[model samples]
Target: MIRIGIVYMATGYYCRFWKEFYISCETFFCIDAEKGYEVFTDSIELLKMNIPNVSFHAIKDKGWIINVSSKSDFICSISERLRQNYDYIYYLNGNFRCLKSIYSTEILPEEQNGYFAALSFQHNRYKSPNEYHYDRNKNSHAYIPFGKGKRYYQASFYGGRTDELLKFSEWSRNMINKDISNGIIARYQDESYLNCYLQDSEPLVLSDAYGYSDFTHYQGEYKAELINKNQYLGTSLLHARSLLPVSQVKLQGNLGDQMFGFAFYCYLKKFWRDGQRKTILSLLPEGRRTTDSLYGVFPIDITDDIKIVEQQCKNLPEKKIIKVTEKFSSVFYQVEDFNAPVVVFDGKWQCYQYAEACEDELRESFQFSLTHLSEQSKEILNKIRSCKCSVSVHVPANTADSYNILLQKIISDNYFERAMEQMRISLQCEPIFFFFRDECPVEELWEELFLISQCKHHIITNNSFSWWGAWLGKNTEKLVIAPKNWSFWKDTPDLLPTEWIKLPINIDKKQLNNIIGQQILKSQVTENIGLYNGKMGYVLFFFHCARFLNNIWYEEYAEELLSEIYEGIHWDLSISFSSGLCGIGWGIEYLVHHGFVAGCTDDILSELDKKVMEIDIRRIEDKSLEHGLKGITCYVSSRISSPRDIVSTLPFDPSYLNELKEACLRLNIKMTQLTSINDILKGIKTYYMKLHKGAPLWCELYCVIDKIEKM
Candidate 1:
């Protein structure tokens, strides 16, 4: 019997691919070292455990293993196989897998009478000539002397008789060493050396079936078909190189970072190509007169919202204008007529400095009415209105150090508590308070402002959004409390109304309390909380809760609210919801459930579908889905004291639960019910089991559950 040895080394993400390959090979043939199918690797211990059927040999020689270049691994593996006196040795990349069984005699070079056996490279998928592989001007040792029309071979997979393979490895090593000595490494490095050596040796040629293209250029299913078709053609091995499907490969460390960077670059390139190309004319009146289109490069960072800027520009009339930018500096509200002598607004916060200047205009231009509230929003609003007084709080947790320090100072000075205490004393009743944290979206910020504008009083920080909210308030007798020092620099009195209270940044809590107590005793405050009764309010509240709690249920509820709102108006809500949920974590699930629920509109069935879809069927680490379920169960449990009340209100029919199971099976999500707090706790545990230890979401969910258990 002819002895065959396959040698490979996998260090990182390649380990995952290697496991698949080893399993596939074992399925086809008996991969035993004593039985001639010997495996060699640096990580023998890992391979031994993962592939128990295969006998592994550890490569102990440090001199032969080169970390900088993969080509060195190829040379080392071949050398080790030669020393072991194997009849035939195959040097395959860790990513190569055997799709079918093959005898050693079939791959051995009989007619060619040469050592190495490799398949000729296939046609380039990108429609470029093969000559693109080499630089003709470079005089490197590994540079192959290319003929006009000769086909090249991939060095990813190759096999040969022991002696011939040794000779080939030595030749490659010498060529690589020579190139290194001359300070000239070939572009393809080791593959270049192999090709150069092959030019002189003229080794046995296998069919293209042995080494087919499996890169991103090729479709996944089609590539899989091609790989399987090779098995039918009596070809055993298929080389995938490093281009394994993302679903199959679990990337780690620098490889994952590099892939993310590459993906980001691709995303940026696509964004640039598809981005709006309109030019904003920032013309100065005294500047040189020219008809030429002024081209200024706007450098965009990752944080910049290109879509928002594009949307803002859409409102302006399409024209170039010259204006004195210094006189009318704020372009956000003034750029109504682009052709007129007005400031040209590029989508930036600096432009929004004068957003307050045209508050009435902005309000009229945009839809901010509360005439169509959803059922859920109506409920939440009623809860908010139950209190005697309402106060909106804005805390910038994710802002710059200056703002964060300001927030810390306010917290330390007991500003928030003092304000709440004053409101309670002043109203002589329980106050309803809303906290706007850092992660709140811009749209939600506006909604919060709209809601706050309807409140009896407002306690805000040095935030522009809060300022806009206070300014937009319908309450003429509204008590607006703000920080004395609005910024790191001196306060700008013009930014706030003279009637507003400007308290010191670091106010003495005892002194302020006494002053606020006296003011409350003297003043006659008689304003009630306003309730939102519009679909917009409901939609806004749903999204706000979704983001704040990081829950998918609220997101889905928001989508459902939009669906209802659109159906009411006879408008297509799918288009708007699709665009809005594009980058959102639970977008895909929401869309899937939306379509499924829309098709099956029975209330009971829809509720079951929602619950089924809410479970992370993807089996991926989706924090949104986890937190969403947690938040939903938490909210439900808190609102309804009795489990029977929850079941009756959000009833889950037994028949529908079975249907939910079937739906979850189809969607691949593991469905669980929140029949009670116990069920929610069980789900938390199940999710915790799936999550890795010390993962941020894992810790967060653990803490949340732990708090609930205590409660």
Candidate 2:
């Protein structure tokens, strides 16, 4: 027996709309994650009404979201249902439409049994190597137009042996595990993976004109050829947007949840204007008009002003009948055959109405903002004197799709600031209040004028800390905002309904600031390399030994002091050893590769001299200093890869210090003559200490300082 299931999370508009469609299936089931008392009772009642020959099962578990992982305990229950001698199983997720019956003359009966047959519409940018391609233009882009004046739909189907499918399932689980570990899924990647296995099966590819019963509302002139079949032998796959014509049932109550209810009614009204009859075939009680169809019952009421709806029937040779019922609430239609010549009425409601509804919801959810009358910003200047300016900022925290949208919005907003100014003027306001969702750090947002505007003037943000800082001044009011269309926060408090300054939903911002801010904040919270106990212990041990070695005179033990200096400094020996392996030539190669100097001639010397001055390598002399004037000199310098390239080793710049003293005499360096001498002596002392460890000793300095008496 073929067992098919229509899985739904909860009762909503789509559920009620597809009631008859699900009932027509061989086997039907509903999976409710929440299992709320009201939803459970209603679902059980609905199941009992349709469950004579059909086997129905419901699992009340909160594992729907955990389906992405290869191992889902929920799948186990589903697998159990499949093992009960089900020859075929078709799983249809909610919010889907059945456009056409799966039976077609083009496919053979043998190919239709034992496996799954799914339909996919190709609009994705990422296409696989083996997928069919046709050329429109010479550009090799995915989903570009193929061939002349005609396009073909390419898809992979999976429907074969049950054992092979079970094997594919195991493989799919493994691939899911690998994908999770590597983080390699790029949108619809699971579908892509499924396509890979199905590719070898050489599945059927529909022409653009083929009849498909899947989702997203199939249109055009070819839909009639696929429907009105006596029986469907194969399963039809669809996207999540399909809606069907339900002539049998007249829907009432909150029509918001029904799939394309109002929108379909509008289309029916238009069809009625085109002289089409309203048909209903169900006698559902409590409504004005009763009607009946092939399977269920319905009632109708005509509400729109387009035309006075009239019920009609076209009796066919096969005893098929079309019934229409009309009243004040809604119109109902029903046909006798299981496969009726139904008009495709998908995608309900006007876009503007949807947008306005979202706007109103947003307004109710957020607070209002005050605009300064004198602000110079064009975006701010166009608001009415008393009217509030509302702007919403979006920050997609973890979702990549949201991130991409956010980046685009940020770029567009920055580009359109001038237009925003003109728009503000057009709106007749002195100042416009802008709202932002700040996800980025304030420190990294130097280039973001949006955030700067809030800091300097009248603006509000969802970033609570920054919002308070912006609203600190005593003279102005603040605004907070939230999204209008989405009420489920998905565990994010940032999206919750709270008192915030309201802003118009500007999807253009995309919430990039949130990402930048989080990154900056993360960096701030996680920085401390040498603070580890082991590292600190090593540092203290090295410091004590270095202090002990300073007591030795350099002239008496220059080689030993060099070793001590090497031991004293914590050299990152990994790089040092790597450098050592590459040898002296590697150091010169690095300098040359970096464009530091050219040629073998004294170019390197000149650059080194310039760097020496830039780094402030200096001289010093003082008896009170730890290392007194000795047979050693020191100079401050950065690391050099090779010792072979370095020629001169100088400590204190005695000549530069003497020159500075004379320059100070000429009213130059802000020091008394005696203080200048002391400064030079301090510099000499520093140079002497450094010479004990860092710099190569100058032979002349050792000779001169070594010749001096201890006095």
Candidate 3:
């Protein structure tokens, strides 16, 4: 006779699911085999009860989250005894009920060239490769890149022979502990690790019928199904902890900010109640209709038309509300537990911890819409991808006006320059540096960020835009360097991921002397912004460190830069975009945007628009976005809602396009710069479609994962 062992854990309140599970296993699980039940739990009374072949071992409760991740390790500790006594061993989910007989052959793996492990099917079987919530945190041992895997397996029910199962358990246990040490709990925790293991493990893929749950609404021949926990635990969180049946999430902030709330939604849905659906309380961004595919966690009900949340609350019985703002931003261990039947999270919710909890989902949903890029940007992207070694250095001058100026002290131009130089020296190949200058020569904002993310490594400021771009980057060996000091109180909040290197800003000798008014200062801020001194290297040092000098220094410098620019605008004679007066005047707008000087560069840039009329549009062959006629025209016309569909980045004046049209009309060329951009985007989509299949990154800004199945 074949010997079979059922390894199970039913600690604390989980014992409530034990009675039904025990009866089902004894009656319907491997009837012909000689069976023994190995139970691990905290209930001492279970040992005294004569429950057939069941033998209970007293186990200290480690909580659900810890227990779920370490379940494999627990079995591994007893693997020697299990393998000796039984011909086959399987660990079934504690909450699932075996409704009919499941034979040993159905659950066991057969040898196929090498040892094979058995894997279970996710409730919802079919999903696009990008739709699967693969752990995106490069720091986590569970991370699986976007295109690496095709199957999304459910961890609730899976098992194999004792020897092969031990191999998987040992590997999984080590990865889980490492994640805990790094303070990372991957998306769906244990399940995320299982998917990571199954990515390359061409294991025997079991049918969805074995792990079926009524909540999935997936009709199939069911041998076993996950029973609802609410029937036993009621509304108490002692069983689930940190997860409660949520009624609705109250959303706040602009569209980009509100996207942070989805992570909280993931936690709330962990232990859901019947008739409960993921619901949001705020109005969505204008164009994102319910019909369209959202970033991730799509098909959720939007109670937008109702303005008053209290009025909206009247529909549901729960009156209590929990708001998660910067006040609660210190959350890193886990989302705070809610005791109420209906949990509500309201506020800016700028916490990265929430994003980390559901990082795979966030990466899928908020995948950057790359189709918004220009043809020139796509060419640069191909070059970045073709090169094995590349690094992006992002130093934001725009944030100086908005954030507290004291925050600027934490980073400097010298910090960026040295970081780039060190990367070049350390890497085997000469690294191509893509430096994000103070004034972006490129017109589109998302294109600039999309380009930065494609690079293999990154150096980011305290800004959120770059923080997201760096986090979304899929490079396996990617290195991200960020400034240690961020806030005025000197507290380094849980903003940057722990895996990223945090270094203090190192000011160079020239920049250091510029600050503290030392005698060794290389050049005056006034002289650095001269008409001729605006060369790349000189401008890199001056514009980057300019914020180090007082606001008055930039105010005087920008004023002087534009005062001389008016004289050069008409007589400079050069018609080229990058080398001409047009480039100098274009860069000054950044100084104005940074709050250095107000309204100083507008008239000079406006007058330079007339200078484009003198050049022949047909003769100029350069079509690159950086220094081409297309780039210049887009800059002059102001990049208004190109393909990003978001509001304009530069805040262009209404008459800007009309002014450009007049210039183009004088030369008899149709004002077709926007049409040219759209044409280029079509060609780029053809290329991405070939690479990503039907799911091209450029089709729409968002990937439509309208999967509404109960995950």
Candidate 4:
């Protein structure tokens, strides 16, 4: 017959859950005194009401402490009882209820096993220091530790075989009694002392079912438990912990917090004594760790209504079991072939933490190291860098602080004048300047870059998003520069193999104090800003568009022109009108009126459709009418699609397209979503004939003005 014992503190709160736990186990005896009779009676009543296998011993006036402090009393309680009668002993706490049922048929023969069993569970939610385990990877389970970064292999101890297990239990009892008599108690009481002293004592690392417990309140640690001792050796199909009986949970009033705390304490101690920590790598047969052997209990099946208990079994890990010390009442097994997943050492072994003495051999034998890159990552980075690009600059369109104010400031003329002066000094070799950020006063920034620096400025961005701005740029041949690595999520993996120069730096300090240094550089320099302006200077613009830069002003035609320029020069553009627009002259109505040649703007299509006199007919039977319409198209297209046009800086929300399209339909002016500059240029070619005949002189003069504007 298999014997199981539950040693509870008999605290008032754990009475109910304990009752449920008692009813779930088979041939189990409770170890609380008669004063704990209320809790004990509750268990007996629960057993009679539901489960019928387990029994309880209401010991009067016996205080058995099980913590980091009290080891001897715990050992004596078991040693004294096991010597009398009992084939197997399962230690359970007061607070936990069985999620499964244990039966006598599950016990393994004593001849086939040595001593321990461990159950694994689901690890953690995040990289929480208190819960995460380092070795827990894609294929393995995670275990939480006691203090910080400490973890223990969870198990439920079943002192199997009265003849063999009792011998160790007696010895464990004697040692504790001796310590008590001598008044010798270590800081870490029974569990800690037993755990520390049991180092070379018992045969450790036996495989079993997965057990779980809430260790935060009681021992202040999280752990797993073991239940199926007989099934640890070989039976793969039977790898499961018996479920606890739900009928055993007493549905009474609230079972106060203390009972919950103590009940969990009991569960923790039961596993601490019986379950041994072994790495998942060693437990697998032929080096294979599968989720099949592991099982979840506490959080899964345990509710306010269920009673859980352990199932006894004989299958154990195939390894040599060495008995360390023959002094404890509960004998621990030392398995030579396995290693503890985590080992807690007395301050003496500080440097050699996380790893055991034999870890070096394990690493050398397995040949494992951290892996960083994949083939896909290498391919993507290379593609982005190898493209020929004229522009590469970060845009500041994100609403970091005061997005409205920054947009206003960016569009201001004074800011552009100052920014232009800086750019004039900075651009020595690179002829093209790239711009990216939130939608800003693009015309103002463009005018300044063109007029002040006398160099072509290019804007590289996908919509108004700042992240898209930086990412869309494919100017690997051009100097790639940005404010800095501003995002915490962004990592500078050696992903981009090419070395692109970072431009946010001060160049003034490098100017030599003597004329000889200047003379040598001046003779070799073909182009210099000082040659025109006669001033030694440069500009370093920070890429962030936060609230601090809100003092700037918006230029008049900035938004209207920017939108047109974007449509003309780029392959993709989405036109939309909105009533709830903010900052500068950014209303949807104003943009639509300025952008009417491209698309119409209105809340309802009925309103704009009524206003449409006629579509600008590309071919009319009368040459004069056809010629007049073509001229208008040419003029509108050229001005709107000019590369210097300014547009709004608001970030593009991907979902805003439908409403924008609806607004365009209101005026019967269908908007064209251009994918590239080539499309708009093709549209320009269609209107070339009318432009030559209807307004030939003005169109020719306008083209000259466009050329002079750049100069």
Best by lDDT: 3
Give a tens-digit lDDT track for model 1, residues 304-417. Answer: 123323333333343422332223212222222121212232221222234334445444433354554445445656755664576777665654333244235423647667
Work out candidate 3's RMSD over C-alphas: 22.9
| Candidates 2 and 3 compared by lDDT, better number | 3
* Superposed model 4: Cα runs more than 4 Å off: 1-9, 26-85, 101-156, 180-184, 196-198, 201-208, 214-711
Candidate-wise lDDT, in order: 0.43, 0.30, 0.57, 0.28
Ten residues in sequence with the least summed lDDT for candidate 1:
242-251
Pairs with backbone N, CA or C atoms under 3 Å apart (clashes), candidate 3? 295-365, 296-365, 371-698
How do the residues 1-711 of candidate 2 rate in per-residue lDDT, one tens digit apiece? 233232333332223433544442222121211110111112554546554434444533212121223222233335554444344333333323334444433322245432445444433223543243432222211112332222223222222233334455566555655444432221232344455455445444433233344442555533212232122211121111111212333433222212123333433333333112232222222534321110111122343211211211222222222333331122223222223323222221222222222443322322223332124443433442334443323332332333223334433454234334534554444445444443344322211222333432333222322332232222234333322322111112222224432333233323423433333343233322121111211222222222333422222232332233234333232111111111112223333343332344234334333333332212323222122211111111112222335564332255654543443344323322221112323343345445553211121121112222111
Q: Model 3: per-residue lDDT, tens digit, 1-711?
A: 888888888876788888899889888887778889888888877867777677787766645655677677788788788888877677777787888898877766777512444445555456676877788878889998888886887777666666777777898888887666544566677788878887876676767567677666777788877777666565444433323233455554333345555555554444232112223345554535432223222344443323334443443433444444444443443445554434555544555666777777666666555555678888888988988887888876553232223234423466677667667766778888777744554235556667787899988876665776677688978888876654322243676777887766543334333332421133333233322223321332244334544445643443544555544444454544334544454455444545545564445355555555555554555654334555456445432322322442433444655554554555444444332322333333444444553312112111101110101
lDDT of model 3 at residue 361?
Answer: 63
Q: Report how far residue 13 has shifted in candidate 3, in Å.
A: 2.5
User: How many angstroms is residue 156 displaced in model 3 relative to the true structure, after the best TM-score fit?
Assistant: 1.2
Task: Decide which is better by lDDT, 1 or 3.
Answer: 3
**C-alpha lDDT of residue 506 in model 2:** 36
Alpha carbon deviation, residue 39, candidate 3 (Å): 1.4
lDDT of model number 3: 0.57
TM for candidate 4 is: 0.22
